[model samples]
Target: SSPLPTTVFEDEATAAQKAIDALKAQGIQRIVLLSHIGYSNDKSIAAKLTDVDVIVGGDSHTLLGDFSAYGITSSGSYPTMAKNKDGDTVCIVQASEYSKAMGELTVNFNAKQSVDSCSGKEHLLLGETFTRKDAAGKTVTLAGADLDEVKAIIAKDAQLWSLKPDASAEAVLQGYAGKVDALKKEVIGTASDLLCLERIPGMGYSKTPGCAEATRAHGGDISNLVAFAFRDMSITSEIAIQNAGGVRIDVPAGDVTIGTAYTLLPFANSLFELDMTGTEIKAVLEEAVEYAVKSGGSTGAYPYAAGLRWTVDLSKPAGSRFSNLEFKGKKDSAWTPLDMGRTYKVVTNSFLAVTGGDGYVTFKKVNDAGRGLDTYLDYAQSFVDYTKKTKVLNRLPVSEYSTQAIYDKNGLLQQ
Candidate 1:
C-alpha cells in the first residue's frame, strides 16, 4: 500500500501500521503478505500485526510457511507450513533460490466473512520438461520446450541466438562461464542407516533431523574440513568463500557415489582464499545476512567458518551483528579472539571472495587476500572416501529445530 516495505523490515512495525491503514481503506478484508522475511522473523511480525492474515516468505530459504505451535520445521529449504492456532492457514512457498523452480501458491479466500477451511499444495515449476534415468541410478528431469511457448516468450526469431540447425541438448543454457545441467540427478549415497532430516522416534528432530545435512553431507562441512585439513591453507591467506546459495543439490541418504558429488557442486566455483582482518571478516558476515533478502544478500556465502567458529546474532542489524569473533589456529588449539589488524587466510569459493556477493564489499577489496585453485572437487572425492572408511557418521549430527512431539530439550523422547 504505502511503498510495501520490502527487505528485512528495517522498520517493520512502523511499515506494517502504514500498510494496515491503507489496506483497510481499500476494504481488503483478508491481508495476505507475501514476503522474503525469514520464518522466525515472520512469526514475530505475525504476532505483532494482528490485522495481517498470512505471511508467505522466502529469505531463509525456508520451505514451511505455516509452522505448528511447537515451532519445529525440517530443513529451511522446501519446508511445508504446518498450522496455526486460529485455524487460518499461513502458506510459505518458494521455488528454490536459483530460479530453477517457480512457486505456485493457490489461496482460496471465502467470499463470506468468518474464517473457514483452506488447503493448498507446493510444487516445482517444470517448464515443458523431459526425464531420463542416468547410469548413476538417479532420475534426471530436464526442462523441455514446446515449439510454441518459446515463440510467445521471445521477442523475435532473430532473438533466438542460433539460426544453425544442429543441436543435441535442446534445453541447455549457460550463465557466466557455467553451463546448466538439463539433466537433474535423482539420488546419491545409499544409506542402510537413514541420514534422516525427519524427526526420529524417541528423538526430537533436533537430536537428529534427517536431510538438513543435505548440503553438509554432500559437501559443505566435508569440503571445508579437507581445505583446512591441507597443510597449505592458513589464516591471512587469500581464500575462496563460496556462496551457500550455490550448494543447492540434495544427496538422498544411501550408498556413497561419485555422480552424486558432481551434481551437488554443478559449478566451476573454485576454491580461493581471502586476506581479511578479523574486523573485516565480521563485516563480511554482516553483509551476507543483511543482503540475504536482496540480490546483494546470501546465506550460502555465510562463511561456514572452516577451522574457525564465531558467534553471529541473526536479530541484530546487518553490519554490526556478528560479535565475539574468533578463529581456530592452524595448529588446532584453543580458539583465538579476533584481531582486526591481523589478516587471516579464510577459504571460500570464487563467487563470494571476488564477486562481492551479499554486499560483501570487504571481500571484493583486493588489499590483501589471495586466490587459489578449487580443491572442492578433491574434497568432494575425499568425503566419499571418508564415508566409506567410517561407514557411519563420526561428527555429531545436530538438529537446530525444536518440537514438542519428538522430545524435550535433553533429547529424551516425550510421550
Candidate 2:
C-alpha cells in the first residue's frame, strides 16, 4: 500500500517511451498500459505518454470488475483516451487484486472521426455505477443492477485497464479438481490415539502437537525429512532448525497429495547444514524466541527443535532471550549448558543459512558452509519413505531434547 518502488514497474518515462516506440513502428493509432501503479501515477504516466490507446494494468490490485467510472487528468492535461478534442479511442481497465471479479467494455468504431484526433476526451468510465441526466436533470442509470449485467459485461468484454502483469486475469478458463474421493479414504500413517495438537493442554503433563512432537522425537524429523531426501545430502547428528514462518501450511491428517507438500513449502529455499557450537545455538534459541514475540507470537507459537530444547525468559534481553539451553541423551539427567567449543551439525532452510535469518548471524561468518540442495523432493520423499517403513512417527516429548554440558568436580551443572 505504501508508495514504494514496485517489483513489476521500472519507471513511467521508460515505460511510456516503450509504448510510444511500439506505436511508431506499427503505425497503430492507440496503445494501452495496464499497470499496478497507484491511481495517481497511472494518470501521470497516461498524460505524459500520449501515443498509447489503452492500459489494462495490475499492481494496486484494484477491482475493475465493476469497471472504472472516470479518470481525471492533470489540471492542464487533456481528458482521457476515449474522448479527445479530436475524439480518439483510448481505454484503461483493471480488476481489483485477488480473484473476485472483473469488467469489460464494447466499442463500435465510427468511421467519421479521424483516427489521429486527440482532444478533451476521457478514456474510461467503468465504475460500478454511471448515470445520465435528462431534461429535468434527473440522473440516468445507464446500466441496470449492481451485480447482474453491466459489471460482468464490461469485465469480460471492454478494453480499459492499467498494467497488472502478475495479477490473475478473469478470463474464462477450466480449473482442474482432484482428490475428491481421496479425502474420505484412510491414510496409512502410524496411528496414535494420544496425538495432541495443543502445546500446553489444561490437563496433567501437556502433550505437544504431533508435528512438534515428531520433531522433538527425532531432531530434524520435520526439517531433515526433506534434507536427507535430497541426493548425496542427509541431515546427520545435528540440530536441524525450522523457523515457524517457513511452514506456511499445516499438514492435513489424511491421504496427502504430492501437491499438498508443495503447497506446505511453496517458497523456493534450498537446504544447507551448518556446523555450529552450542554457544551459537544458545544465541539462535534466544533470537528465535524474541523473533516470535515480535512477529505477533501466533505465527511463531510453534517453536522448532531437532536435537535440543531451550526455554526463554521473556524479561531477558532480546539477543540473549533464552535463560536455559540443554540437550538430552539419557534419562534422569538434568538439563545443562551446551559446550561452547564443541561443534554441532545444523541443518536449516537456505533463507536463514545465508541471510542470518531469525537473528542467527554467527553462521554468516561461515561462507563455505553448506551444499545447496532442493528440499521439496526431499520432503515428499521423506513422507513416502515413512509410509513404506511405518506410518507411526513415534514422536517423543520435547522434554527429551536438552543441551550437553559437563558438571564440575561435584557433578553440579551450570546453566
Count: clashes, candidate 2: 67
TM-score, every prediction: 0.41, 0.51
Instruction: Point out where model 2 deviates above 4 Å.
Output: 1-31, 34-53, 64-92, 105-176, 179-188, 198-233, 245-283, 295-298, 326-345, 350-384, 401-415
All-Cα superposition RMSD per candidate: 17.4, 11.9
lDDT of 1 by residue, 1-415 (tens): 1111132535875687688769878998777677676767776666556455556666876543322322444344332343433445444445445643344555555655323434443333334434557789898864445445543443342212222322444433334214223222323334444333221122122223443433322223333333332223332433234444554443344654555555445555545555567777777766765665345444354444444444444445557645655555545556566688887677665555556655666766642233323344343444445445555432222221111122222534333
- Residue lDDT tens for model 2, 118-227: 33222243445556687799987765464455566557644442234332442322121234334323344543333323221111122345544433322333332332
Stretches of candidate 1 above 4 Å error?
A: 1-241, 293-301, 367-393, 396-415
